[model samples]
Target chain A: MPDTPKRTVFYVSDGTGITAETLGHSLLAQFPEFDYDEVRAPFIDAPEKASDLVERIERVKRRTGLRPIVFSTLVQPAVVAVLHRAEAHIVDLFGTFLGPLERELGMPSTHAVGRFHGILDNRSYQRRIEAINFALSHDDGIIQDGTLDDANIILIGVSRSGKTPTSLYLAMQYAVKAANYPLIPEDFERKALPAPLKLHRAKLFGLTIAPERLAQIRQERRPNSVYASLENCRKEVEEALALMRREGIPWIDSTTKSIEEIAAVIMQHLQKMQKYADL
Target chain B: MPDTPKRTVFYVSDGTGITAETLGHSLLAQFPEFDYDEVRAPFIDAPEKASDLVERIERVKRRTGLRPIVFSTLVQPAVVAVLHRAEAHIVDLFGTFLGPLERELGMPSTHAVGRFHGILDNRSYQRRIEAINFALSHDDGIIQDGTLDDANIILIGVSRSGKTPTSLYLAMQYAVKAANYPLIPEDFERKALPAPLKLHRAKLFGLTIAPERLAQIRQERRPNSVYASLENCRKEVEEALALMRREGIPWIDSTTKSIEEIAAVIMQHLQKMQKYADL
Candidate 1:
């Protein structure tokens, strides 16, 4: 078999290019067998910047003897025209979708640059910041009086079961106030929910991980301790799972799931509960 | 003058749908005058799920008397086919870009599902989790000995200058170890950088907010206090700006920028420094 061909892929946009890069990565993931060297050309709002990027793409193409791939969300026509001159396969993201949307809405796009990720509305932006602060303050069971009352959801799991990151992601991405509590050995011994959590049972979610994975993660934090022992991990996970089942709180296994997947599952559970509440 | 048209928009995907939703929001931001009710249809990996989503979209269309717009990254051809049956204007993100990418690469895509945001590699996933942990531990100037040395970037600013959220965003989105320190009144009084920060001056980046904005943010935390007073806010911001300028540290005003934009600007600065160091 021939060696895998390598190509340079650029995610270019007038703004931060995060959206372009995210969609570009999703599309590239379909071709897992190929090799790609990815580059981000963000803040290409000016024609001069676009010209510079085109030069960079040309340099890569000449150096590798292969045409590069450019995924662009550029909104400015002049900038897009400049990028079009590159010796590459240009995937114009905004151009492809905007025309259809304009026809459907009976209005032309304003062709604005850097609007989506900017501080567009003060209220929503402040809410996001407040949510982040709430997540941080309430992380790892650091709860103050009446704080848990404001949380949209509270996550309960053993340490290293993927609570903090999930809470932060939910808050940052969706502006949902998430507070996480770690289920310690004491909770398992008592065989009851934490005092604060009992009041917010309706808003509670659980996360469990495989004992082996939990052990592996704990070993990184404290090597050769009982916390990192497989036996201890097994007991904690088993008890946590049993307790969650007994309490009828929803739970998920985070052993093989990414933070994004875990957050999405949690949001679905919240939506379902809201639907039931409306009934 | 007529009232703004209202429409339902669905971001549908086989995976988390975050990429689809993000790009969809960017597209919608162009039409700022219109009103939209947005919904996320994530994890539609099967044709049955796709069919269910189509029903939901059609119901929205029937209620609104307008075709709902769908931005989809559904990879499975069967699921995509089912989604196409909806009475909506579909923006098939994958279909539009994948064909061109395949032709450029001279290979067919595997059409796999949920690969981009999943834990594809254990090492990279671990790195991201570790970065999040680092950001949390080093947040708000809570630093241990030798901890700041591992940071990829160190953010310094007055309280509520957008350090913590930006640090968390950088860690979550880019797997970057970001440590943040608050520049306090003492630092201003001393007219010198903090001792811990002086050792790592090269990694330091500053964030400043407009005094009025800072006062507003502080009022939310500590109402009717000296810290929340506009006079104090003005003095602190002025001193922080002066100190950063004197120290030759790069800084940006966070008054109007989102976390994504702030993180993107910092990353650009880091990249430029790396390029210069290479020379």
Candidate 2:
């Protein structure tokens, strides 16, 4: 890590700042040699806030003797002009893309601020809210019977195997009807599929974690208990993987994967399955 | 809407494709006059897959008699080469920035793929997972005792005013420990802050919604109930806003705001409060 140069990076936006961060992070990740101290400065809509941000960047430059890099999605020109006072490289995301788009469309832009996240009382927003409510109601095998009927995807996993967060993410981000079921000792003892899960076999995706990692996670919740024991974790993971294999379910190890990765893999798997069905 | 030109846009990635979508969406939002038909292609790692993607783009061009716009974050050179076969404007995000970064760092990049969403057994990952767990356990005033002590922020809103999703999003995306409290009728009738919430006044953020919109949202849940009536919704929204103003708690209307916008506003407010405390 010490071989790389250290620099300050700021993602500034008039709104959520997610766009600036996504673009900046992707660009910085490409280098992989610089150690970045990144900070997110969202809602810099006013000139005062922009001036304050510039001052902070100047302070960093003075202290480190290295110019900071600022990735900005500030739509207002007045606010954006204030940021130029900072001793840093400015990567203006909106300024780079908006001109081309306006020319292509043959119309002037609305110059809207934070339009990406502004709420509309439209079907898309309603569907997202509905999906979120459905995910929460169906979480952790809650109301297992009729709930699976509407689920676009059902995740099956052992305890602490990254099911809940992934389910919520798919629902929130994509409006996918996602439900999760936990495999317990009783199901492992049966050596057969749970009766309820068998009905939704086609929608099932399994998540498994390394036994050692699972043990460590479980220990945090129930320290020194049998539920957190390595032996119990090993048995559960082995049985869970076997169950998924026996049923020919596509599974991924959640041990070293983020919820984003898990959800993407599941979405890709679904798309493939849908394409096969079309044929 | 028909006055504007129609364009087909693709967000392509070698990983989850989220960054592509986020950045692309912000860019497209700037051109609100144009109607965009968007597709997301994720996990296109292999050259074969890239070839298929190019073929799909070619098909779109032939059918629409217009060129498509492809926003790609594909890292591998071989895969990117195949994509050039398509008749489209390729906005190569990674290729555009990677070279400059490599030059600045004075080192060649690892050229690693999918590093953005890949999980490492590091403190950051653990913190995110822990935050998610905390948000879930502390959701909706569940186990109200001592839970607020750990929360970075507490969201207060009337029922269905978009509290839960915002809370969960903050936890997942930013690793902020957020909890939400519903403003029940009892508290509104009393015209005072809830006793427990008063203890953590500094961390409180309020969400209100337009009465008509709230009525529509509540109507979906209970078609004919008084709880979903316009009169009831109007009353609730009015009282909620009054209460927030009285408490001097910072508030935003969730009626025309996405969860992302709501969270950003709250975060900015928190930062301002923190800076004042520092002074």
Top TM-score prediction, candidate number: 1
Using lDDT as the measure, which candidate wins? 1
Q: Model 2, B1-279: lDDT tens per residue?
A: 444345789889988898888877777777665676776798899999999999898888787777888888898888888887788877777776677666655678656688775432255666778778888888887744575888888889899898899988888777788888999888988999988788899999999999899899889889988999999988888888899999998889887778877877776776677732210
Instruction: Give lDDT for model 2.
Output: 0.82
lDDT of 1 by residue, B196-226 (tens): 9999999999999999999998998899999
Please give the range of 10 consecutive residues that has the lowest summed lDDT in model 2 chain B.
Answer: B270-279
Off by over 4 Å in 2: A1-6, A31-33, A46-56, A76-86, A100-110, A118-122, A275-279, B1-7, B102-108, B119-121, B144-146, B189-192, B275-279
Candidate 2 clashing pairs, residues 3+ apart or interchain: none
For model 1 the local lDDT of residue B72 reads 90
- Model 1 ranges with Cα > 4 A deviation: A1-6, A119-121, A275-279, B1-5, B119-121, B275-279
Q: Please give the fraction of native interface contacts (Cα pairs under 8 Å between A and B) kept by each candidate.
A: 0.76, 0.74
